[model samples]
Target chain A: MVPTSYYIILSAALFAIGVLGVLIRRNALVVFMSVELMLNAANLVLVAFARERLSIDGQVLVFFVITVAAAEVAVGLALLVAIFRTKHTTDVDEVSTLRG
Target chain B: MESLQIPPVDLRLLTPLLIVVGWASALLLIDVFFVPNGRKKITGYLAMAGLAVAGLAGIPLWNVSGSTFSGMLVLDRYSLALTWIFLIAGALSIAVALDYLPRHEIEQGEYYPLIMFAVGGMILMAQSADLITLFLGIELLSITLYILTGFAYPRVASEEAGIKYLVLGAFAAGFFVYGIALIFGATGTTSLAGIADYLSRQPFAPQDETLFLVGASLVLIGFGFKIALVPFHMWTPDVYEGSPTPVAAFMSVGTKGAALAALLRVTLAMEAARDFWLPLLAVLAAATMIIGNLGALGQSNLKRMLAYSSIGHAGYILLGIMVAAERGAEAFLFYMLAYTLTNLGAFGVLIALEQRGEAAWSIDDFAGLYQRRPMLAVAMALFMFSLAGVPPTAGFMGKFFVFTAAYAGGLGWLVLIGVITSAIAAYYYLRVVVKMFMQEPVRDVRPELTRGLNTEILIAGVATLILGLLPTPIVLLVEQSLVALGG
Candidate 1:
């Protein structure tokens, strides 16, 4: 059986990579995918903890997270579409009309 | 197989929340089926009526308190008081949107229902006793706001604002979920009461300490982004400037107030770890006040200025939460109400000055307003003074209460920082007043004072003054509304 520490370390690394992606990535779509990656990392942690503790609450929370993430994606993609319609680009750099 | 058993649910405890969500859901259908194009103002009026009904529903539950849904949600005076405030803010947003939407040619019936849904999310946040519910509430509010932020169709800036807000908001949610997961791992539970129980138990396992503290800090970061603290406030000015003015007004007050309410509960639940979080929050409060005020100084746009000012006010309210377990809840509630009225009123004036083709939001737009429109100038001047925490205004009373509370809570240094930064903040807020009263008009611009906008400004203005002058009644009510965790 895998140790809980191993899962925690793996999840933490995934989360760190996700954060770096969000920071370094210029494309809105990629940045959003990175957010999904971060959320999945959290889900992995939750499932690991649930298995370690022999409880179902953490696993249940994973379902909620996944559901909410779906809703987020729907809105996020729609927003992207809205922006794309006007600018014809999803590059974060090009959407600088609001800068001071 | 054994038969499944459900926990006895208490429907009565959710009367106010149910009214809001149910009414909003119904309004969506009613809007599509009945309300026609160019008559979306009917939908706005209906939304206001729903909020009024919800507020009335809460009055009967004022003295009642309990947890329902197997302790997922609790209805206490804390949630009740916040319910009234959220409802009022919702109604006022709808009121302002009624005219502004038609004028901007963005009159969509969906806007009113969406605001109601957002209000429902806020009430849920305040009533949540478990992390799961809180997470849902935050997402509900965020998702609704993302749509509303981009409601201004075909405007590239508005859509850009929507995407920016979504990206940043989702980033924060990532942090929030990870924090909750770590917290659950540390304590094997997601319920606030359960976590408190674990924390207060004997021997206090040292292995869990690091996990819990890290998790708590991450959660604070999530909220920091939402409330626009210094390091996490990057999206605020752009988003406020890009979104529609009425939506900006609603987000400025509604989101911050709801997040603060939830934060109060979270901090109070973890009171066993006060030594860990108290100083951390104090430093944050101090930084937020200084940087938020400083940020506002250079802003030329009215929305951006109020965005920064709202951040500063969040900092002051944070001081109240720091000492809430002992003596800060009343101050927090009062400050929330006071700031709500004043900030909304300030934005209402901006809405009045806003034009169709060109958003007359520059500070210079207010120049010589007293000569052209005395009543509008007076209202704007009053709002500015209130925001600057001047004498005999709600903002002043709010600052006084929070500073006194912080001082009593042994946070004298934070109180001192608040005072100095407030003095600095006064310059910017008063800058608007100076422009309105003294300087000559930069351009010949006419402010549209529609009936809806006029009524909103009047209600907010009159309430701000009354609360400032005679604070005793509301103060007593807020004192009585102290959060009782034992519900």
Candidate 2:
């Protein structure tokens, strides 16, 4: 049987990678994908804790989180498509019309 | 296990929300059936009328306090006061939007309904006591705002602003949900009161500290994005500058008000976690003040300047939260009211000056505004002074109370920094006033001010002045409401 600490550490590492990708990547699509990765990492930890504690609430919450995440992704992807159509680029740096 | 009985829905407790939603659906239906071609000016009036009725309905429920919907929502003075604010903001935004939308040629009949839906979500958010309800309320507000931000579809900047807000807002929502899950897992409950009870009793184990901190930090980050606090305010200037002026104005007040209400409730109720969140909040508040004010100094566009100015104002209001006093809550309420009136008045003038089918958004556009329209020039001056914290104005009084609360709470350094930033903010604000009064009018520089009703302008101008001159009654009302919160 795997130790709970191992799962926790793995999830933490995954979350860190997601954070790094978000901060370092200039492509908006990649940034968004990184955000999804971070969220999934969180969900993994949540499921792990739920299984470890034998509680239903944590799992129930994960369901809601997944639902909201899916909705968010839909809106976000629609926005990306819209932006790409206009500016013709997905690079975050090029979308700087309002920058000070 | 015995079956749990669900309580009947209390219409009185949910009157404000129901009224807003009912009006929203009614407006949608009106758009669908009666006004297919979208020549629906009356829909704006109807929306305003509905919000006014809801505002009136909220008056009687000010003193009523209770939880409903299986403890998911709480109807109390805090939410009631904010409901009135949101309703008034909705009415004002619709009034402004009515004239501004037609001129821009983006006259969708659904615009008014969307505003109502957003305000409805805000009302729900203000009253939410459970995490599920809070998330739902935020989504309702955010999704509508996302569409509204980019209503001028096909415009590149508008599309960019909309996409930025949608993506970042969704990311923040993820953080909010994950935070809720972790918090619920640790406490065995999702109700704020339940979490507070559990945290108060449990000893702080080092192994669990990381989870607790991460959970609370995620929730704070969610609100930080919404309120546009430092490190999380990257989307604000672009969104505010790109969106229609009225939508930006509505968002400046509506989103901040709801987010602050939630922040106050969660932090105050979660008594065991003060040591964790307070210092982080203080640092953010300080950084937000410095960065926001400094960012405003170089901006030439009037709307972008005000956007940064609003960010700075958020920092000032966050000072109230940092203090965490009963007086702090009172100060926060007073500051929000003052901010709502003053910002609406400022945007009212901006909307009045905006030329048809052109973005008259720059500072130079306002040169010699006094010569062009003396009443508007005076209105803008009043708004600028109020925003800069000039004495005898509501803004000054609000800032004074916030600073006083901070000082009383032993955050004197923060208060001092606040004073310095207010001074820095005064410079940019006065520069606009100077351009209005002193600069020569450029050739062929005409702005459209005829579309707005004389009555609306007069109302905005007088409200700004009166609120400035005598803010005692409103201050006392805020005090009373905070007391009712049992803070």
Candidate 3:
């Protein structure tokens, strides 16, 4: 059987990559995808931990995360479209009508 | 295999929450089918009615205290008090929006229902006793707010603010989920009480302790963004400046108060690890107060200034939460109520002055307010005074209580920083007052005052002064409502 430590390590790497993507990407869509990736990484952690403990609660929480991620994507994409219609771009830097 | 036995469901415990979510759902359908395009105010009124009904439902359950859904949700006076605060904030927001939406040509029947759902989410956050429920509650609140922020669909800035909030909020949510997973990995349970039980039986493997501490920090980071602490508050000014006035008003008080309420519970549940978090949070609180106040000093836009001010206010509220185990909860509740009324009234005045155009919300717009509209000027001055911690106003009393509580909890430095930042904050707040009362009208701007807007400002302004002068009754009420955290 695979060790939970290895799973945690892989998920941690994936989470870090997601955070990096969010920070480095200028396109709003890619940044949003990075957020989804981070959430999935967390889901990976949950499943691995649940399996290690033989507990169903952690696994159940994964479903909730997925459902929420979907809802988030729905809203995120809608907002992107709305911004695109007005600003004609999804580049986060371009959407800077509000600033100090 | 034996039949699976479900945990005993306590429907009565969830009466208020159910009423809010249920009414919001039904109202969504009703708005779509029955409401006409131009008559969206009916939906707003109906939404207020639902919130009122839900508030009334909580009155009967004031003395009731227990958990339902297998200990996922709690019903206690603490939750009940927070519920009424959220409801009042929601209703006031709806009232402020009643005329502003149509006036700005962004009136949508869906607006009111979304606000109710947001309130429901806040209530859920306050009632949650488990990490999973807290995650759901936060998401629910975030999603609704994202939509509300973008509700001004034709406005480019609104769309931008909405997307920015979504990205940042989702980023925070990701951290929250990862934190919960780590905690569960370490303790084998997600329940607050279960976590406390796990921690109480200490002497854990060092690996587990590291995981628990990391997880706790991650959770705090997630909440830090929600409550607009210093480093995490980048989105606040832009978001508030872009969103509709009423929605911004709601987010300022509603989101901050709810998130802090939940944070208090989380911190209390982890009381066994006080040495680990106490200093960390204290430093964050100090930075939040200092930086937030300094940030507000430079903003000329009323909404942006208020946003920064809200961040500073969150710092003050954090002082109460840091000492919540001792006497901070009472202070926390009082500060929330005072901040709610005071901030909402300030924003309500902003909504009154707003006109249909992109270049609105300049500080100069407040010039000659006294000469043009004496009543509006006076109300704005009152709110400014209250927010600046002037005596005989709610904000002053709130600051006093929180400072005293922090002092008692041996956090003297935090209280001092709070006072100093407040002194700095008074400059900007008083700038508005001075402009309103003294300056000549820079732009001959005619405020579009409606009955609903007037009522919002009146309710909030009067309540702020009343709570400031006679805080005894509410203080007693808050003290009694501090139920024992089963965790």
lDDT for B168 in candidate 2 is 80
The digit string of per-residue lDDT tens for model 3 on B1-487 reads 9999999999999898999999999999999999999999999999999999999989989878999899999988899999999999999999999999998999999999999999999999999999999989999999999999999967888988899999999999999999999999999999998998888888899999999999999899999999989899999999998898899999999999999999999998999999999998999999999999999999899999999999999999999999996678899999999999999999998998998864459999999999988999999999999999998999999999999999999999999999999999999999999898888899978987899999999999899999989999999999888955533
Ranking by lDDT: 3, 1, 2
Model 2: pairs clashing at backbone N, Cα or C within 3 Å: B394-B468
Per-residue CA lDDT of model 1 for B215-271, tens digit only, reads: 999899888888877688889988998899999999999999999999999998898
DockQ numbers for every candidate? 0.72, 0.44, 0.70
lDDT of 2 by residue, B1-487 (tens): 9997878777789898999999899889988788856467788888888899899998888788898888889998888888887887888888888878888887888899999999999999989998778888898899888888877655667776887787788778767866775675566677888877878786866666667678788889999999999989988999998888889999998898888878888887776778888889999999999999999999988899988999999999999987766388888888888888888889888888787756777888889999998878988998899999997777888899999999998888999999999999999999999999999876445656654434456666677677778877887777767655763
Candidate 3 regions exceeding 4 Å error are A88-96, B1-4
- In Å, residue B24's CA in model 2 sits off its true spot by 1.1
lDDT, candidates in the order shown:
0.90, 0.83, 0.93
Ranking by DockQ: 1, 3, 2
Off by over 4 Å in 2: A1-7, A84-96, B1-8, B36-38, B450-456
> What TM-score is obtained for chain B in each of the predicted models?
0.98, 0.97, 0.99
Clashing pairs in 3: none
Badly placed stretches (over 4 Å) of model 1 are A88-96, B483-487
Which wins on TM-score, candidate 2 or candidate 3? 3
